[model samples]
Target: MASAMNSLIPAFTFILALVTRMEKLDLKVQSSQAKSIGTILSITGAYIVVFYQGPPILFSRPLPNLHSFSVSLQSNWIVGGFLLATSSFLISLLYIVQTWIIKDYPAEMVVTLFGCIFVTILSAIVALIVERDPNAWTLKPDVELITIVYSAVFMVSIRSVIYAWVCRIKGPVFVSTFRPLGMAFAVFMGVTFLKDTLHIGSVIGAVTIALGLYAVMWGKANEVQIIEENVISRVDSSSDKVPLLQNKSMEV
Candidate 1:
C-alpha cells in the first residue's frame, strides 16, 4: 500500500512532464531507449525499497512490521490513499510552476526564500489548527531540536535552492529522475544508524539505482553533446557567410 502511494509522485511527475512537453522525448528518439530503461529500473528499484522486506543479512533481524494493511481495514487506507494522490498531483503541479517561475526570475536564493516562507506559513497554520497542546510548542535544546533546526536550515534550505537552480537549467525531468535514489540512501542510513537489517532486496535495489543513474547521466551527456554540435555548426556556417557577404558588398 505504501509502495503504491509513494510511487504516485514520480508517476504523476512523469505524466505531467509529458503533458507539459517540458522535455520532448521525440527529439531524443535514439536515446529514449536508454532513458526508458532507466526509468523502469529506477521505478522498480524504488518499489522494491518501499515494499520488500526479507530476512536480515546485516546487523540483527529486521524490525517487525506493525502497520501492515489488511483487507479488513480499508477505510483509513482509502482516506490515506486519497490524500497521497492529491499531494502527489499538487507536488507535480508545483514542480511545473516552479520551473516556469525560475525561468523568469532566475534568482535561486529569492525563490527558495519565498518557498520556505510559504511552507512555514502553511505549516504553522496547520499546527495551530491541530496542535491544541501548548506544551508541544516548547523546545528544549536537545537532539531533537537540533535535528529539526539542521533539517530546516541546512538540508531543506540548501536542497530547495539547488533543486530550483537545477530545474531552471535542465528542466523538471532531470530533477525527477533522481527520485528513486532517495530510497537507496534511506536504506543505507537505516543500516548505519538504526541497526536495520540489510536484505537482498535492498542490495539489488541499490545496484539498480546506480545503473539507472548512469543511464540518465549518459543520456544527458549525449543531449548536451548534440546541443554543442549544433551550436558550433551554426557558428561555422555563419562565419563562412560573413566573408561572402563582405565580398559581394565590395563588388557592388
Candidate 2:
C-alpha cells in the first residue's frame, strides 16, 4: 500500500504541473531549450529515485517485506522525522533567500554558501538535541533523515535556483519542462540507492511518465513559438503602416 501510494505521487505532481501551466503537451513545437532543461531535471529525478528506492531491494536481508508495515517507529522514527522536517524547512527558507539574493549576488555562490551554512546549522541542532535527550533519542542514525536533508539542500535548492536563472535567460517553458525530469530523478534514485527492485508495473509507469513529460514540453514549445511569430508579424505590419502614413502626410 505504501509503495502504491508512493508510485502515484509522481503522477499527481505531473497533473498538478499541467494544471498550473508549468508544462506542455505538444511535440511539433518543442524547443531545444526546453529539451535541455527537461533532460537535466529527468536525470536528477532518476538519480534521486534510484538512491531512495534501490536500497530496499539491494539489501533485502535487512529491509522489511513489501507486505509488512507493522514495524514500530519508537524513538528513532520521532527523531528522524523531526530532523527531516527541520531540514526541509531550513532548505525552503534558504530557497526563498536564493530567490531574492540572486538579484544582487551570483546565484551559484550564494546557493553554495547557504548550503554550507545549512549543513552547519543542521549538524549543530542535531548534536544539541541528541545531547539534551540522549535516552529519548533513537539508537540508530537515521539514514532517511540524512537523505531528505541532502535532497532538499542540494537537489531542491540548487536545482530550483538554476531553473529560475535559466528561465530568466531563456524562457518559462524551458524551465518548466524540468518538472518531469525531477520526477524521473526521484524514481531513479529510489531504485538505485535504496536497492528497490522495479517490477514490470513500475517500469511501465516510468515510461508513461516519460511520455507525459515529453507531451507537456512539446505543447509548451509550440505555444511559445506561435506567440513569438504573432508578435513579430504584428510588429512588421505596424512598421509598414508607419512608412505609408509618412508618405501620405508628405504628399498632403
Candidate 3:
C-alpha cells in the first residue's frame, strides 16, 4: 500500500506545480501532452495497486486466501491506505517548499539543517503524545540504537542535503519524477528480506508506473532541449543585428 502511494507522488507533485504556476501545460505541445498522459497513467496505476490486488503470483508461505477487493475494504487497511496517500502528498509538498526556499536562500546545507531541527522537534512532540510509557524512551546499546544513529546521520541528514541541492538545481517536479523508483526498491527489499507475497496486480502496477515515469522523463528532456535551442537562437539573432547596427553607425 505504501509502495502504491509512493507511485503517486510524482502525479501529486505535477498537479501541485501546475496549480502553483511552477509548471505549465499546453495541450498543443507534444511534450506537455506526454507529461499529462504520464501523470494520468501514474495515478491510475497507484489506485490499481491499492484497490486491486489480483491473485498472488508468488508467495514464500501460504497466506490467507481473500479476494483483492475484500482486502482493500478492511477498516484498518483503509486507514493505512489513507495515511500512506496523505504521506505521499506531504512529501510532494515538501519538495515544492524546498524548491521555493532554495531559490531564495541558495544554501542547501543550511536549509537541510533547519529542516532536520524542526522535524526533530515535531517528532519529539508527537512521540511524547503517543508514547506514554517511560520505558519506550530508553535507548539501549544495541542494534536498535545503532539503527537509529545510522538513520539519523545518513537517511535523514545526508538525504535531506542531497535532495535540497537537487531541488535547487531542478524544479520540484523534476525531483518528484524519481518517486516511482523508490517503489521498485521497496518491493524488491520487502520480497527479498521479508518474504512478502508478490501479486499480479502489484507487478502490473509497477510496470505501468515505470512506463509513465519514462514518458514523463522523456517529455521533460524534450522541454529542456527546446528551451536551450530557443536561447541559442535568440543569442544568434541578437549578434546578427549587432553587426548591422555597427554598419549603420559607421555610415552615420
Candidate 4:
C-alpha cells in the first residue's frame, strides 16, 4: 500500500498536468520540460524513500512474527497493490472532474457535504457485503466512538471542504504534488508512536523527497512570479496603446 502510493505521486502529478495542459512535453515549451523534470525528481525521491529500507539509521523495531497475522491478508499484497493503484488513478481523475465542476458551480460546500453522504451510503452497502459477520458490525462506545466522531468531523467533513476549495483555486496538479509528504508523515508517526524501525534507506528517501519538494516549490514560485510580471506588462502595454486611439469621432 505504501509503495504504491509513493510511486503514484508523480503519476498523479503528471496525469493532472496533462489533464490541465500545463505540460505538453514539447521542446518549444520550456514550462513543460521544467514541470516534467520536477515530476520526475519528486517521483524518484518518493520511490527511494519508500523502497529503500536499508540498515536502520536509528533504533530498529523488532519484527512481529508472521504467524500471528492472518495468512489470507498477509498473502494478498498483489491484490492490495492493484487495488491501491486503481484507487489512485480514480482519485487523479476525480480531482480533474472536481476542478471543472467547481468552476461551473462555485459552491464547494454542496459538493463536500453531499459527497460525504453519498460515499457513506455506498461504502456502507459495500462493507455489509464484504464483512458478513454481524458481530464485527457491533461497535463499543469507548475509543472507537471517539475515533469515529473525530474522523467523521475533522478528517472527512472539515478536510474535504478545505480540499475542495483549494482544488478550485490551485487546480488538482498543485494538490497532487504534495501527496508524497503523507508517506513521510506516516513514517514519522509510526516511528514515534509505534516504535517502528528507522531504516537508512528511509532517511535517504526522506532527504531526497525534501529536495524534490524544494524544487517543486521553487518552480511554482517562479511560475507565479512570471505570471504576475506578464499581467503587469500586458496592462502597461494596453495603457500605452490607449493613448494612440483617435480622439476625433463623428456624431453617431
| lDDT for each candidate structure | 0.78, 0.52, 0.82, 0.73
Alpha-carbon runs more than 4 Å astray in model 1? 1-4, 59-75, 243-245
Worst 10 residues of 3 by lDDT: 62-71
Off by over 4 Å in 2: 1-160, 167-196, 243-252
- Candidate of highest TM-score: 1
Best by lDDT: 3
lDDT of 4 by residue, 58-144 (tens): 795655673487545446777878888878887777777777888789899999878899999999999989999999878889998
lDDT of 1 by residue, 1-252 (tens): 655455556567667877887755764465555666666777787777777766667865445663465656446877887888788678777888899999999998999999999999999999999999999999999998999999998788999998899889877767777777878888899888766778888888888877876776677667778889999999999877757778899999
At residue 77, give the lDDT of candidate 2: 58
Which has the better TM-score: candidate 3, or candidate 4?
Answer: 4
Residue 109's lDDT in candidate 4: 93
Off by over 4 Å in 4: 20-34, 60-77, 243-246, 249-252
**Which whole-number lDDT from 0 to 100 does residue 148 have in model 1?**
96
Clashing pairs in 4: 49-205
Write one digit per residue (lDDT tens) for candidate 2, span 148-189: 778877776776567557544434434444444555565567
Q: Is candidate 2 or candidate 4 better by lDDT?
A: 4
Better of 3 and 4 by lDDT: 3
